[model samples]
Target: MIRVEEAIAIVEANSTKMPVKQISVSKALGYVLAEKVISPINMPPFRQSAMDGYAFKHSIRHQYDIVGVSQAGDHSNIKLKTTEAIRIFTGAFVPDNADTVVMQEHVMANKESILIAAMPEKNTNVRPKGEQIAKGEVVFEANTLITPAAIGFLASLGIMTIAVYKKPKSAILVTGNELVKPGQKLKKGKIFESNSVMLQAGLQTFGLEKTKVYRVKDNLKATKKALESILNKFDIVLISGGISVGDYDFVKEALLQNDVKELFYKINQKPGKPMFFGSKNETLVFALPGNPASSLTNFYIYVAPAIKNKMGFAEIHKPKLVRKLNADIQNTTGKTLFLKAKYDETNVTVLDGQSSAMLNTFAVANSLLIVPQEIEEYKKDELVTLLPID
Candidate 1:
């Protein structure tokens, strides 16, 4: 078995980002831009009023004549003299001679004229043309992540579509003879299958929602057939169970029979020592242990990064930090240990029920405490490294 760091490096070194494609900006949230976008026109497009008030050329006078009204979406051609003002609402186009606006609350209005309460500064309450952004300027650089605000900004700029990295197509294969569907009746010596749904949910968290799932019994022919069918059709293939060295464990041999190049067989880590990673052409394959907790942990540590890297993300790993341990813990397995725990900003506490087959502790865990092989014991208040789940 290889070390955990070595396994992670291997997976990252083999990943390649997907090709770019053009998509509508309305549906491009959470996608990374593949090219820089330039503004086609100046934001606001014209001199705009910043408030509902009277607009006129600023002068030393305290009273002025009100000529006409300018609503938000209409063009106003009203001419203003030196001591003349026009009623203008917010976002309305300002007349050519209007240089300043006094808010309606600060002025007294009458039938055909308004009296200013106080003399205002020149060019106040007016949004100059191109104030937000100028035309022909770079609005967003390459590798920018699309957010809700970004969508609105682009839509306001009349941008209908943008170029982005296409998300990878993925597939999952579940292999076990003693597994049954969740709603079905439990026969003798049978357990409900939970890894497929768990892994699917994990993938969906990273914007990989469209995935195909397949199931096969512990048979070599069936496993090989399943592998052969999807080996070249998808960018990632995740297989759960049948990777260990047992009589019914036929995943390794089936992968070999299908001409898949094995990158690594196992890792020197707890709860996931029998993990397998391989590749056939461009398809990356990960065969995880059948245990629900182990499968989910390996998915988060290994598979999540691979998916993110393929989608052209810069930061693929979970956020890491060092904090003091709230309670004592020990590791004597001579391998890296990943324990589910809860952490405040100051300290981390390892939760109970750290069994490989159980996910009770993981359900409440906000982070995974990493205990290296060189450390045997950690007392309370000792510093520890953790990967906080996002």
Candidate 2:
């Protein structure tokens, strides 16, 4: 058994970031960059007009001769003289001598000349070269998550591919004899199996959808065989159920026999006291308690961080904030308790039915109130620590 903090530290120390791969910028969405990106050229490459109007050197004069038309993609070297302007459209490169642009609506045009409604500020309606990003500049640092705006920015600089951490592949092994698949008839002493589906949804939250779910009966030979078959096939293996000290519990023995080194067997927390963490080479193995709520909670606190760290998340820990308790709490000794709770901006209220097997309260919980192991009681309106749930 170990404290929650120690358990977290152990998981983090063993979870290393996954190897990097080169992928197209278009396909790199939601992936963390494994290397910095340097801009190969200036974002705009040249000074450009920002509006449909005339480009000319700034002047206080009211009229100017319209020398030529400059649309986008025009790269001609037509120079502008004083009292002369070019009919330019938006995104058109500014002529060599042009320093400003007056919008078409702001000027009245004649056949060969236009009257400026007023003397405008210098450099108005013009996007200067390298204004957004300079050539050879480091645009994004390593570990930065690629977003849609980032993709657009990189595309503007002509970036075709990027280096990013690969998402972890996962496998789930469910062990039990008294379980039945959902949508099937409920036989005696059997309940619907749900941990695999629930965990699949959780893994998808981190963009890890290439997960395989396998089932094993409670027999030791079957459990060992199942663990051995996929022990090296995934970056993470979640074994739900058969971890407690029951006659049918063979997960620990099977993991050890299959070269999975046990890092820890338990955590000093309510509902998840029987959790297990182990490793074989680079693959992480977690033997979660069979109770649905406990399995999910342990996964969120322990297993999720491992996956996230391997995926290059900057912060792999969940945040805990202090909020005033909306009601009193009767605490128990010898274990750190996690009670499903609802919290507003200023207050947190513990929900009812906090047993390890009941997930109803967790369904409506926005946070988990943390009750330290040594604490015995808490009064109303007391300050409490809470971890927000995603």
Candidate 3:
């Protein structure tokens, strides 16, 4: 067993980056860029009108000749002489020699001639070339996750494909013979198999939807067989249950027998003390506790970070904030406790149902109050560190 920080350090030290692949920029959302993306050319390419108006050199003119019109995508290579105005619309290229634009709302048109009731200042309503981004500017740094806005920006830069860290494919193994699929009638000691579904849904949030499920009976040979088969296929494997020192707990032994190096077997934490982490070459494995709440909590704390690391994310953990506790608290156990907490934007109150089996309170709780292992008691209104359930 080790401290929570030490466990995280071990995972971070061993987690390796996945291979990079080039794909369409539109399909790279939620993926980290493997290389810096630079603008290939100046945005707008030429001076453009930023408003529906007339483009002209500001010369204190109240009326000018409406020589020609310029609209978006028009290749009219028009130029304006002094005191000349051209009808223009938003996003249209401004003619050469035009340094300002007066909105149509402030002008009155009479036939082919127009009158400027008010003139904008010089260079007003004109989007200068390269104003948004220079040709050589680095718009996205390596390791930056591509977002929707990033897709648009990359498209504007004429980038069709981008190099991004490949998403890690994972396998989920839920072990136990006392489990049955949902919608099936319970037979004696059988309970609904939720860990596999829960894990798959959890992994999907990270855009890791390419997950396969395999259930095994609580037998050494069955567990070993599942481990050997999955370790050869997936970059990551998540096994729920059968890690504790129980009569039917065969996952730990099965993992060890298949040459999966045991990095850490346990942590100094509650709800998930039997959390197991191991690896073989580039494959990372997490043996989460069986209980639903414990499995989800451990998944957030450990498995999420591992996936982020593999995806080349720079930050693994969510930001922690300190909030005042609404009630007094005490902990005598020699292990850290991640108490389900309800943060009502003002103060944080620890929820009642904190047992590993209960997800009722866990669902309502928006944060986890971090109570140190050595701390005995805390008075009401005291500040406590917590991580939001985002």
Candidate 4:
């Protein structure tokens, strides 16, 4: 068995960056930028009012006379001279001659002229052109994820399209002859297939949507044929079962027979020691344990980050937080254990069960408490690393 870090390093070395493509801003969310996005025009495009007030010069301290009324999207044709003010609403362009703005509430207005109660400050209430974004400036850098706020920022720069990396295609294959389809009546010793559904939903969190699920009986011929058939279609293939040393486990043998390059066969981790990884024709193949929690945990820790990096994201790992353990934890040596835990601002508590097959306790889990291989027991109030669920 190999260490977890060694296995991760092997996977990262074989990972390839995806090519870039131009996509419309409407459909660019969650994709990583391939090129630097620069602003073509100044944000606001011209000097505008930041608030609903009156536009005038600072020299006109006490006197105020209405010259014109300017609303949003209106061009100011009338210029303000000494002691002259224009009624301006929010987002209206400020005239060239105007240098200050006095709020309407501070000024007492009559039929034609107004009374200034206070002196207006220079450049007050004015959103100057290029104040938010300057023309020809790099608004976003390459490999940055396009979020909702990022889209708005690009729109403000008049960018309708952007270059982003294409989403990678992934597939899930479940192996077991005793497994029956959902909605079907359960027979004696027959279990419903739930791994594929759980994995599909979990994979979606990492922006993977176009995933296909295939079921194969417990046999070498069937597993080999299924693996070879789906190998050419997807960039990554996830196998849920048939990787252990049982009599029916044939996924590893089938992959070897197909000339797939083996990265690592097993890792020194609990409930997932049989996890395997390989590649063929630049397509990745992951042999995960049959247990639901084990498969999901492995996917989040290793596969998800690999997919994100392949899609050109600059940061592939999720955010980690350091928290004090509320209880003492024990773990087997020589393998890093990622146990489900409940964490909040005050403290973090480990879940009741650490079994790979269990999924009930993981539902309410907000973080994963990591225990390194070198440590045996963590006393109460021990600071530990926690990986937040994204």
Candidate 5:
């Protein structure tokens, strides 16, 4: 069996970003930029008023006559001279001769002449041309995820459309004869199916908006039929359960029967050692464990990053923070473990229940306490890597 890091390296080596496509700025959110976005023109293209006030020459300190009124989107060029001011609203273009703006509250206006109570400062209340962004400047770089802020910034630069990487289509399959739908009556020894829903939600956090899920029974024929039907339709297939050594576990057998090339099966990790990975034609497949916690952990630590890479995201991994353990932790000598933990600004406490079959503990966990296989006992206050839960 390979180590978890080694397996991740293999997955990364095989993954590639999807093709780029042109999309409107509205639909570009969460998609990776395929090309650099350069400003076609200066932001605020011309000098405009940053406040609702009077536009006048800063050199004139005395009261001036109100020559004309300027509102936003008005194109009339009304230049100001000494002892002359123009009534201007916010965002209106400043005339060529005006060098400053005096707030309306600071001036007493009449029909013809306005009383200036305070002197205007040079360049005050003025939004200079290209102050926010310069023409031909790169506003966004390639491989960046287009967030809400990015979209707003691009739109401010008068960009209506952008080129972004296409999102990958993924199919999720959960296989187990003993598994039953959530609303169905449970039989003896049967368990409710939850891995499919959990995996789907997890994938969405990585910006996967489109996902298809299927439930296949624990049989070679049924599994093989399902794989064959969806082989070419999805970029990746996530299968849960029936990958272990038990006689009823037929997922590995079904993949082989369907000519799915096995990449690697099993890894040196707790609760996920029975995991399997393969490929049939161009579709990548992962046969995850049956336990809910195991499935989620495997997806986060491995599958999620692979899918993000395929979606053109440059940084595929989640953020990790260094935390100090509040109590001592003991584990086996071999196989890495991801223990559910809760942490705050001061300390991190590992949950008492660390079993792969337990779901309640994982529910309250804010982070995963990662323990290496070589360490047997972690002393209190020892610094460890904490992977945050999405």
Candidate 6:
């Protein structure tokens, strides 16, 4: 057994970045860049027009002769004299001789001549070449997250692919003969298996999409066999059930037999005190309590951070906040308590149904109120720590 902080530290020390792989930028959303990305060409490769307007060399005169027209994508070599202008559209290349552009709305056009209703400043409405980004400039440094806007920026720089830290391959193992898959008729003393589905969704929320699920009977032989196969094939393995010191709890023994070194077997925390963390070679394993709420709580507090670390994220934990308590609460269990609750920017309210088996409150709760072991009670409006659930 270990304290919650010590268990969290152990997990963090063991988690490492995965190998890098080159993937298309278009498909690299939510991935951390393993290499610095450089721009191959200047954004707005040429001096572009910023508006549908007339391009002209700046002069003191209010009127000018319209020499020619230039639309976007036109490779025009037309030159302009001082006091001469050309009809131009948005994004159109401004002739080298032209230094300014006046929006169409600001100019009065009559036949081949235009009068600037308002004399514009020099370089107005003209996007200078390389204004956004210069060629050979570092677009993003290593460990940068590829957001949707990042994809567009990279695409604009003509970057087709980027090197990113590879996402971990993970699997979920559900243990217990008393569990039955959903849609099946419930036999005597059998319950529908939901931990696997809930865990799968939880993993997806952390960006681990390609997860495999396995079912095992609550026996040493079956549990060991499942562990052997999964530990060798996955970077992460999540087992729900069979971890406590029960007659049929074979997961802990099976893991040890399979040479999985236990980092910590339990944590001094509420709802998930029986949680287990171990590693077999390079594969990380988490044995969560079978109770639905406990499994999910452990997944968020521990597994999600491991996933983020493997993918090279700097900030792994969910956002932590401190707010005044909206209601009084007590915890006399002599253990740190994690209570699902509702929170706004300034305050938090611990909801009912803090039982390890119930997830109804968790479904509606947006945060977890952390009650320290030393604090037996907290008065309403007292400051407290909260972790907003994602």
For each candidate in turn, the TM-score is 0.93, 0.94, 0.97, 0.96, 0.95, 0.96
Off by over 4 Å in 2: none
List the candidate 4 regions with Cα displacement exceeding 4 Å: 118-120
- Reference-based lDDT, residue 359, model 3: 86
TM-score: model 4 vs. ground truth: 0.96
lDDT of 6 by residue, 1-390 (tens): 677888888999899899999999999998999989889999889999999989998889999999898999996958888868999999988899898999999988987899999988999999999999999999999888889999999998889999999989999999988999999999999999999999999888767888999999999998999888899999999999999999999999999999999899989999899988999877999999999999988988899899999888868987789999988898889898999989887888889999999989999998888988788999999999987885
Q: lDDT for each of the candidates?
A: 0.91, 0.90, 0.90, 0.86, 0.86, 0.91
**lDDT of residue 59 for candidate 6:** 82
CA displacement after TM-score superposition, residue 85 of candidate 4 (Å)? 1.2
Model 1 lDDT, residue 218, Cα: 100
- Top TM-score prediction, candidate number: 3
Model 2: which residue pairs collide? none
Model 1 lDDT per residue over 1-390, tens place? 899999999999988888999999999998988899999999979999999999999888889998889999989778889978899999999998889999999999997899999767999999999998999999998877789999999999999999999888899999999999999999999999999999989888868788899999999999999999988789999999999999999999999999999999999998788999999988899999999888988998899999888887768887788999998888889989999989987988999988999898899899889998788999999999998885
- Candidate achieving the largest lDDT: 1
Residue pairs in candidate 4 whose N, alpha carbon or C atoms collide under 3 angstroms? none
- Across residues 92-116, which tens digit of lDDT does each residue of candidate 3 receive? 9888788899899999997577888
Model 3: residues >4 Å from true position, as ranges?
none
lDDT of 4 by residue, 1-390 (tens): 888789878878777877788999988988999989889999879999887878887873677788799998888568677878888998898988887778878888886787778766789899998998889888988999999999888877778999998888889999998899899999999988888998888778768887999989999998999988899898889999999999999999999988888889989876578888999887888999998888888887778778888889888888889998899988766688889998888689999987898988888898888888888889999899998874
Candidate 2 per-residue lDDT, tens place, 1-390, comes to 899989999999999999999999999888999989999999789999999999999877879999899999998768788989989999999987889999999999987999998667889999999989899999999988899999999988999999999988899999999989999999989999999999998898888877999999999999999889898789999989999999999999999899899999989999789988999999999999999989988988898899889989888878788999988887766788888999988998899998888888888998889898888888998999988885
Question: Quick one: ranking by TM-score, best first?
Answer: 3, 6, 4, 5, 2, 1
Model 3: ten consecutive residues of lowest lDDT: 75-84
